[model samples]
Target chain A: MPTGAEWAIIALSLKVAAAAILLTLPLAFALAWLLARKRFAGRMLLDTVVHLPLVLPPVVTGWLLLLFFGQSGAGGRALQALFGTTLMFRWTGAALAAGIMALPLMVRAIRLSLEAIDRRLESAARTLGATAWRAFATITLPLALPGIGAAMVLGFARSLGEFGATITFVSNVPGETRTLPLAIYTALQVPGAEDSVTRLAIASVVLSLAALLVSEWLVRKGGRHVL
Target chain B: MSFDLAIEVPRGDRTVSVTIAPASGITALFGPSGVGKTTVLDVVAGLVRPSSGHVRVAGETLFDAAAGIALPPERRGCGYVFQDGRLFPHMSVQGNLTYGWKLAPPAQRFMTLAEAADFLGITALLDRTPRTLSGGEAQRVAIGRALLSGPRALLMDEPLSSLDENRRDGILQVIERIRDDLALPILYVSHDRAEVDRLAAQVVELA
Candidate 1:
C-alpha cells in the first residue's frame, strides 16, 4: 500500500497539471487564432518560436525559464520588488514550468482546429449583423471547441508528467511541490524503497492512461462537432 | 427596395465594371465562372471595396469611395447565402436560427424563432447539430437563418450550385416560397440559365 505522502504527491501533481492547462488555454487560443487568421511579418518566426519548447529538451526549457523568471532574473527581481512574489523553489514555479512546456501542444491542437474552420461561416455571420469579434465568439469559437478540448487534455497530461522542467525550476520539495513524477524519481534514488517506487510508478502510468483516454474521448466529440 | 451600384474590379487582364440600378424582385447576375458575378455581390455585401464606386441599398448609402464611406458587412443589412450552407456547426438547428434573430433590431424583427423554423420546415431538426443535417436540410436552415435577420435585401451567390439536381430542385422550391412570402428584394447569382429562368424576375448577364 502507498503511504499518505505518496497519495498527496499524486493529488498535488494533478492539481498543478490542471492549473497549468487552465492558465495556458486562453493564451493558446489567442496565439492559435492569430496564427490561423492573420497574415503579417514575422509570422513564420513566431510559429517557430512557439514550437521551440516542443523541440528542445525539457531540462533546457526549464533552465531557460529559471533564467528568465528566477530571483536574479530581470522580470523576477522586478516582480519581487513590486509584489514580494517569488517563483523560484515554489509550487507556482512548477506550474509555470509545466505550462511553458505544455504551451506548444495546446497551440498546435488549437491551430489545427482554427484552420479547419470554414471562412464562409464567418462571412455569413458578418452578413447577418455579427461584428468580427461577435462572429468569433458566436461562430468561430464554438466551431473550434473540439480542438480546444483536445488541446486542454493534452496539455494537462503533459503537465502531469513534466519532470525535467519542474525539477530544474523548483526542485523536489515535499508538501509544497514534490509532484508525482519528482516523487517517483526520488523514491527510485532512495535505497530499499522499491515498493514505494513501484506504487508511484504505477500511479503515474494509470494517471497518464486515464488522461489519454479522456483526451481521446474529447477529440472524438470535438470531431463530431467540427463536421 | 432599390439598389444602385457602380464598381470596377480587375480580373486578370480584364477590368469588370458593373453599373446597375436594381429594383425589387430577384435580379439574377447570370454569367460564366470567373466573370466577376461573385465579385459584384462581394462589393454589395461589403466583402470587397471598389476602386472607384458607390453602393446604395434601399436608400441607405452602403459605400461611397468619393467620400471614403464604407460600411462593414454587419451594417450593410444584406443577408447572404453562400454556395455552401454556412450554418454554425456547433449550434443546434434552433440555435442557428436564433443567431440572426438576436442580431435584428426589435422593430426590424419580423420572424420569431418558431416562425423561422416553421418557414423552413425545420421544426423537428431544431435541437440537432448541423453536422447531422443533409445538404438540402442544411441549405434550408441557412435560408431560415438569413430570413430571420430581417434583411433589407438578400444576396444569394449560387446557393444551390453545389447540390445535385434533385437537391437543387428541393432547395429551389423552398427559395421560391421564401421569395413569395417575404417582401425583401433578392440579388441571386448563378451561372445556370435554367436556375435563372426558374427563380429570377430580371436577369443581368455579366461578361
Candidate 2:
C-alpha cells in the first residue's frame, strides 16, 4: 500500500503517460499511414529518423529533445513566443519526452497493420463511389482498429516506463515532473526507502503486464481479418 | 451506355496495348491468364494510368491522355465487381450494400437498398458479416452493392469463376436479368468460352 504522497506520484505518472499517448497518437498514425502506403523520395530516410529514438540511447534522445526544446533553443523559444508558455522542468515537458520515446512503438505497430491491409478493398470502395479520404475512413481505418488499439496500449506502457528521457529533458520535481520512475529513483537514494521502492516496482510491473496482455489480445483479434 | 478505350499500359518489362469499343450491352474481354485482360478493366475503372489512351464511357470522356483529362475511379461512376468480391469485412452485408448507395447523389440513384437486395436475392443475408457468407452469397452481395451505387456502367472481372456450377448458373440468371432488364453497359471479363457465349452480346479477345 502506497501512502497518499506516493499515490499522488502514481496519479501524476498516469496523467503524464495518458497525455503522452494523446499527443503522439495522431502524429504516429499519420506517419504510419504514410510509411505503409506511399512510395516517394526520402521515404527510407523518414523511416530511419522515426526509428532513431528506439535505437538511440534514451539519454541521447533526451539530450536531442532538450537541445531542440530547451528554454533558449529554437523550438522552445518559438513555442514560448506562440503560446506564451514554457515546458522546461514541467510535467508537460515530461510528457513530450515520454511521447518521443514511445512514438516508434506506436508507429511500428500501426504501420504493420496498415501494410497488412488488402489495398484491393480500397479500390473496391473507390469504384463504389468512395473518395480517397472516405475509403480510408470507412474501410482502412476500421480494419486497422485492432492495430491502432494495440499501438495505444504499447505506447502508454512505454510512456509509463519512460525514465531517462523524462529525467534528462525535465529534471524531476515533486508533484510536477515526479512520475513513478522518477519517484522510485528518488526513493532509491535514501537508505530506509526499500519498502517504498518495492511497492512502486510492483505497481509498475502490474501496469506493464496489463498493457502487454491487452496489446496481445488486440493483435490476436486483428489477426483474424487483417491478412 | 458504351465504352471506347484505346490505351497502352506498362507491365514490368513489357507493355500491353489494347483498343476496345463496345456499344450498349455486355462486351466480354476474353483471354487466358497473364494476358492483361484485367488491366484493361482497371484502365477503364481508372485504377491504372495508361501511357497513351482515351477512355470514353457513356459519352463522357473518362481519360484522354493527349488532352490531360483523367477522371478518378470515384468520379467515373463505374461499378466494378472484382474477382474475389471485396466486401468490407467490418461491415455487415447490409452495410456493404449501402456503402456506395449512401455516397451516390439522390437524383442519380435508380435503385433502392431493398430493391437491390431483392434483385440480387441477398435480402436474407443483409445482417450477416461477409466472413459468414458462401462464395456465391458474397458475389451476389458484391453485385448488389455495385448496382445500388447508381453507376452508369459495370465492370466485372471473373465474377463467377470461384463458384460451383449450380451457384454459377444462379448468378448467370441474375446477370442475364441485369443485361436484358436493367440495360446498363457491362464490361465483363472471363476466359471461359461457354460463360462468355452465354452472357456477352459481343466478345473481344486479347491475345
Candidate 3:
C-alpha cells in the first residue's frame, strides 16, 4: 500500500476542482450571456482572449500565472495587503490557475447553448410582463441549464488534470497544494513508486470519464425542447 | 383609452403607417408579407420602435415621441404571440401558463392557471414540456400564457401562420372562443385574408 498520502491527494484534487468550478460559474454565465446575447464591437476579441490559454502551451500559461500572482506582482501584492492572504504556493492559487485554464472550454459550451436559444421566446416573456432581467432569470437561465451543467462538469474535469499552471504557480507543495497530477509526477520520481503512480493515474481517468458522462446526460435531459 | 395607436415604420424601401382607434373587439392588421403587417404589431407591443409615432393603450400613453415617453415592452401590458409558438422550453405546460400570472398586477389577474388551461383544453398536458406538444397545442399554450398576464390588449403577429391548414382551423376556433369569452381588445396580425375574415371583427389595412 502507498499509504494515505496518495488517497489524500486524489480527494484534495477533487475538492479543488469542484471549488474552481463553483468560483468560476457566475463569471462564466455572465461571459456566456454577453457573448451569446450582446452584439458588440470587441466581442470577438474578448472571446479570443478567453480562449488563449487553450491553445497556448500549458507551461507557458503556468509561467504567466506565476508572473501575475507572484508575491511581488500588482494583484498579488494588493490581495496580500488587503486580506493578509497569499495565493502563491497555496491550494487556492492552484484552483485559480486551474479555473483560468478551464474557462475557455466552459465558456464555449455555454455560449453555444445560449446562442441556440430563440430570441422570440424571450420576447414572448417580455410581452408577458417580465422585465428583461427577470425574463432571463426565469426563462433564459432555466433554458440554458443543460449547457451550463455541461460547462461546469467540463471545467471541473479540466481543473483535475491541470498540471503546468498548478506546478508553476503553487509549486506542488506536499499536503497543501500538491494535486493529483503533481502527486503522480512525484510518485514517478521516487525509487520503486510505480504502484502508487498507477493507482493515482487510474483514479484520474475514472473521474474524468465520470464527469464527461454527467455532461452528456445533462445535455440529453436539459437541452432545448421548444423553438 | 381603449386603443389609440398611430405608427409609421420603415422596412427596406417601403414605409408602413396606420392609425387605428379601437373602442372594442378585435382589430385585425391585414396586409401582404413585407408590407409590415407584423411590424405594426411589433410597434404596438413595444418590440419595435416606430420611426415616428404615438401609441396610447387603455388611456396610458405608452409611446409618445412628442412627449419623449417610450414605455418598455413589459410595462406596456401587451400580450404578444409570434408566428411561431414561443413557449418556454424548460418549463412544464403548467409553468409556461403561469409565467405571466406572477407579473400581472394583483387586481388585474382575471385569468388563473387552471382557468386558462381549461380554456385552452390543456389540462391533460399540464405536466408535459413544450417539446412534447404539437403545433396547435403549443399555440394554445402560448395564448393561455399571454391571457394569464391580464393584458389590457393582445398583440398577435400571425399566431396561426406556422400551423398546417388542418391545425390552423382548430387553433382559429380557440382564438374565436377566447375573443368571445375575454373582455380585452385583441390586435390580430395576418397576411392570410381568410384567417383575418374568419377571426377579426374589424380590419385595419397596413401598407
Candidate 4:
C-alpha cells in the first residue's frame, strides 16, 4: 500500500470512530443516569447487558451484532423494511460495533461521577421552584458535565482502537470498512511488509497518544471546577 | 402564613409524631439533636411525605392524606435553606440567587434578581462561583436563592449552625432583617436556645 492509502485508512478510521462516539454519547449518558440516579426493577439486568460487550470475547460480541443487525436478522430486516437502511458490511456497521464495545466504559465513567453528586443540591433546586426536569438541566446536568466530557473522550479513544468487532461485523474492505487496525493487520500478514508495519505502528501510537492527551487536557480543564 | 400539621414519620426504629399549628411570624422548631425538628420542617416543606397525615398552610392544602392531595416540594412554594447551603457549584452567585426566581411563574415572582442580591449583600460576588466562596458567603447565597424563589413560606433548617461565631452572628442579623423585611412566614429549625431566644416569636419544642 502507498503512503496515501495508509493515510486514507487512518482518515476512514477516524471518521468511523467519530461517528461511533456521537452515536454512543447520549445513550451512554441516559444509561449512566438511570443506573446512578433512579431505582427501578431490572436495573441489574440492564447494567449487565450494557457490560456484556466488555466481558464477552470481542469476536463473540461481533458475531452477536451480526446476528442481530445483519440483513436477514429481525433488527436488520426491520431497519431495511422501514427506513431502507443496511448495516451489514458498511461503515455504519463498523460504528455500531465500536459503539457497543465502548458503551460500558462510557457509562461507568459517567455513572461514577454522577453518583458522587449530592442529591441535596437537586433537592435544594427543587425548593427553589425548579421542576424536576429543570433541576436536572440546571443543577445535575451541569455538575455531571466534567464526567460527560471524560466519557466522550474515553468512548472516542475506544472506538479508534476497535478492531475485532469491526472486522467480524463488517468485514475488512478498503475505504469502505477497513479501519486503521484492519489495515495494520493486513500489512502485517503479507510477506516483505515489515516496513509498512513499522510505519503504521508508529502512526497508530502517535494518533492514540494525541487523542489521549486531548482528552486528558479536556478532563483536567473541566475537572478543576467540579473538584 | 401559618400551618396545621400532624404527622407520624418512621425514623429507623422510632416514630416521630409531632403536631403543632404555627402562628404568624417566625415559628422556631427548637429541639436538641436527633429529636425530629428538621423532620417537621421537612414535612412542612413537602420534602417528606408522611405515611398518613395532613399539612394545611394558611387556607391552602399542601398535603392531605385524607384528600389524597400531596403537593411535591416545588409546587408547595416553600423555599428551603439547608444547613450546608447546597449552592449549585456550576453557577455563579448571581445565577444561584436567581435560579429559582427566574424559574418562578410570572405572577408568583415577588423579588427581582437585583433585589435578592442586594438583600443578601451578595451583589459583589455575583460573578463568583460557589467554589471560591467562604462558608458564610455560601449560606448567604443559599438564603438569597431561596428567598428570591417567591415561595409562599420559608423553611430554614439550621441555616447558621455550620458558621463560626462571627458568621453566625452575621447570618442571625440577616435572618432578623428577613423576618422584618419579608411578609412570608419562616419555619426556622434550630437547636440553639440563643437563636430561639433571639429570633423566634413562637417556639415549638420537639422531644
lDDT of 4 by residue, A1-227 (tens): 33988888888888998999899999999999999988999999999999998999999999988999888889999999999999988899999999999999999989987987888888888888778898888888887887888888788889988999999999998888989889889988899988888888777788788878877886787677666
Task: Give lDDT tens digits, candidate 3, residues A78-194.
Answer: 888999898888889888989989998889989988888888777888899999999888877777888899999999999999999889878979877899899999989999989
All models, DockQ values? 0.85, 0.86, 0.82, 0.80
Model 2, range B1-207, lDDT digits (tens) per residue? Answer: 598889999988989898887567899999898999999999999999999989998888999999999999999999999999999988899999999999999998999998999898889999999999999999999999999999999999999999998899999999888888998899999999999998888899998
Where is model 1 more than 4 Å wrong at Cα?
A: B10-14, B164-180
| Candidate with the greatest TM-score versus the true structure | 2
Q: What are the fnat scores of the candidates, in the order listed?
A: 0.93, 0.93, 0.98, 0.87
Candidate 1 vs candidate 4, TM-score winner: 4
- Candidate that beats the other on lDDT, 1 or 3, i.e. the better one: 1
In the range B1-207, model 4's lDDT, one tens digit per residue, is 576678888877898887868688788888889998888778877778788888877667998888999988888888888888888887888888888888789898878988888887888999999999999999998888888888888889999888889888888888888888776788899989988999988888888
Model 2 complex DockQ against the native = 0.86
TM-score of 1: 0.94
Q: Which candidate is the best by lDDT?
A: 2
RMSD of each: 2.0, 1.5, 2.0, 1.9
> Tens-digit lDDT track for model 2 on A168-215?
999899988999999999999999999999999888998899999999
- Model 1 lDDT tens row, A1-227: 67888888888998899889988999988999899999999999999999998999999998898898887899799889998999888888899889989999999999998998888888888999999999988888887888898899899889998999889888888966799889888888999999998999999888889889988988888777675
Displacement of residue A106 (Cα, Å) in model 1 is 1.0
In candidate 2, which residue ranges exceed 4 Å CA deviation?
none
* Chain A, model 1: TM: 0.96
For all candidates in order, the CA lDDT equals: 0.86, 0.93, 0.85, 0.86
Clashing pairs in 1: none
Clashing pairs in 4: none
| Chain B of candidate 3 vs. true chain B, TM | 0.93
